[model samples]
Target: MAERRVSAGRRRHRAEWLRWGSLAAAVAVVVVFLLSQGQDIDVSYGQSPASSDAVAEGGAGELGDVTVPSVDEMAALVRADDVVRLPGAIASWDERRVREAVGDAEVRILVAPPGLDEDERDRVRDVDDATVRVIGTEVTGGIYQASADSAVGWRAQFAVGDVTDQMVALIAQLRDRPAPEAVDQFDWRDPDEAELAAVAADLRATGVHVGAGATLDGIPEDLAASAFPDRRAWYVVLPRQPFGEPVPRYGPALAELFPDTPVVVVYGWWIEYHGPHAGDFDEVVGASFYAQLGERLSLYDYPQRNVLAGYLARVTDVRYAGLFDRPLPYRPFDPLRVALPALPWLFTACVAVYLVLSARPLLRRSGAGARTGVNARLAGLTALAIEVSGLTDVSGNPSLTRAIGKLGAAGEALARNLPDRHVRSLLDDAEAELDDTARSLGRADYRPDSYLSERLA
Candidate 1:
């Protein structure tokens, strides 16, 4: 009968454990399912457009009443105007520099940048377009890039060829080409009213009408569709860091957005590493940009810049790199989970240890290990340690040290003479204060409150 009872208890214990384990597994599955339920989004970059669609399309009509300004005409206009809105960089327009560039009139130029000095403030005309305007140093293949990401990141990059007839022809063609699908709008509210009007007038004079509601997508779609094939990307400098150091974030921005157009991102140091310092040339050298989507681009060596451009084209050679609107992929918890698998193991180990420690008290069943008075023994040892270790002046307690010292001496004597007997035999510590208090209370005539105090008094 005892053996049968023991078997029945074992079966019940096993069933209880299985129930708890099943519940824990169910909770884990629910948690993982909830976490994985979200939608996925990602974009693959560097695919090429189909070869059939590779040809540049055009609906480029005549350059109507507005005469196509030759590169020199635009250059001359830039030199002669009172407030010249020439497309150039933020850094290239210091007060003394812009003043010199304008030559005579009290010239002021404004750009979309974070900081400028008191003298710099005096020079800014206004910040109408936040990205940038383009200006070419010399390449007939679209040279200047206009970055429009933001004040901190990469801005728009557009071509500003040498102020030449071919450059003018290209500009006219670009102006007439259809724009792309609408882009997110840009808010153009300048704080200063006068500055706004002046910039408005400058754009108007150049024949590019500034409609009141014009946004970043103001340029018609046809224009963009026409330039799809021949457009060469350039490095458009945007804002710098705390101290005027240029770091553009546009290549990644465009790489993520305008996957159709191969955009390039190059930094200043890249050029510094290759050849002669840019400072030696009296003119501002154009930045070399790259697009990873094109067939591996190779740069032309003569002017030295085309070499960089060439390299960009060659690398982005795969198809679909030029697709404008494709889905971005889903990526989450990859790096974190891969880098630290130990976190889950550590968490599980702690839980298991806690369950084991808690279940220890309940393990005193038929075949379970002996229910040793582990806690009671621990408490006894702790009390004994305190009685021995405390200073003689421990408040509200007296005789504790004396009794403990006598016990220690008795223990030493036992070790020497009666090695086999317990130390309690010699100490004669037959009375425990707590046990005596209980015995005293058990007696019929006990009064804890009144008699104890009176006796002490």
Candidate 2:
């Protein structure tokens, strides 16, 4: 019985140890998984030294005959004047107006001559911190860069014409505002003033601050007004032109106009937008809306008021819904990608549940074993009382004496299995009582008649 009990105890302890080992192994898996996830390194879009080397090697291999302006010279020119027009560059008569509009601001504009080669364009692009830098060549169109944080170089196709008026108008809207107003509409081309005002009123009704103007001359005063306080985004609607005609690239210029906020331009049949929120605008309202507008305008030889109104209404709807506030929809079959961010947390929760389940049975068995041990000890005490009272001797029954001795042996076995110090003391006391009884009964030695002893042997 003792040997069997010892084997059972070893098996229970091994099972308990296995449960703890499993938990440790589960924790190790979570740690390893977390370590494998690693960190994300942010990559900036700004030009770097290595990128400059690559561009020099891959682009315009040799500087050739094209003379490129030095960075020092460009910086000096910008510091001296707000508007610098290099030789052969597009001449704008509105340079004085641009200067007047820019007054005291750090903004600078440099217009490169038409027909500048790639090397010359690259040199102009290399000029940093300029508010507006444009290369006026038709072959590569024109390139403009703004000094804003989210500014990116843009290319616009413009006919060789006096852009001085356009530049002055752009600067006027850009200047004095300090910030972009929400849903400001500029009608650079001829449009119905009443219809435009109606569109603005509808947008205002939807709880957005809107400012609309039909002329470029009124921009400065309108911008200074306190009616429109929210500076967030702007939309420019240019006069509709023929499908194949090359109109001035006002979209890129308008994008540079605000610098900080997104600007959308509806020029002729083309729709262009730029800024940090450009992607959000595309996700909320796609380019298809403008494409359909172009298709509808094709049916009419002249600009229809209702058609334009419908288009403006759509723009108003997008503005009312908050263009940049909406989140982009997830791509198809992208469940795993979306859930990947939360995978570590989900894995931890699953591991915790597994640990709880694994330990529950072990805990229950330990508690049951403790209670059974105490009950067996009490039963053994009852048998010891019967022996002490001389019940078996009074009946003169050998079977009764053997049964009582077996019960006492079973109790001793239970007491040995118990871990409590009090149970051990009870076992020692029971053994002392058995020894006294044995001596009293005329036995030379005390021997417990346990049935398990014979069976186990």
* Candidate 2 lowest-lDDT run of ten: 147-156
Off by over 4 Å in 1: 2-160, 163-326, 330-373, 376-457
> Against the true structure, what is each candidate's TM-score?
0.22, 0.27
**Tens-digit lDDT string for candidate 2 (411-434):** 444435544565556545544555
- Over 1-457, each residue of candidate 1 has an lDDT whose tens digit, in order, gives 9999999889867755653464354335334434544536354543332122332211111111111233444445545543344332222222332233233423222221212222322223222211122222111112333222221111112111111222223333334433222222212222254543443353335412222321222222232222223443223221112222233233333333334433333322122111112122201222222322111111110112323333333323321243222232244556534534343343233333323322333333213233223222222322332322222111212233233333334433432443323444423341132223323334322222333344346
Choose the strongest candidate by TM-score. Answer: 2
Clashing pairs in 2: 88-113, 89-113, 180-231, 181-231
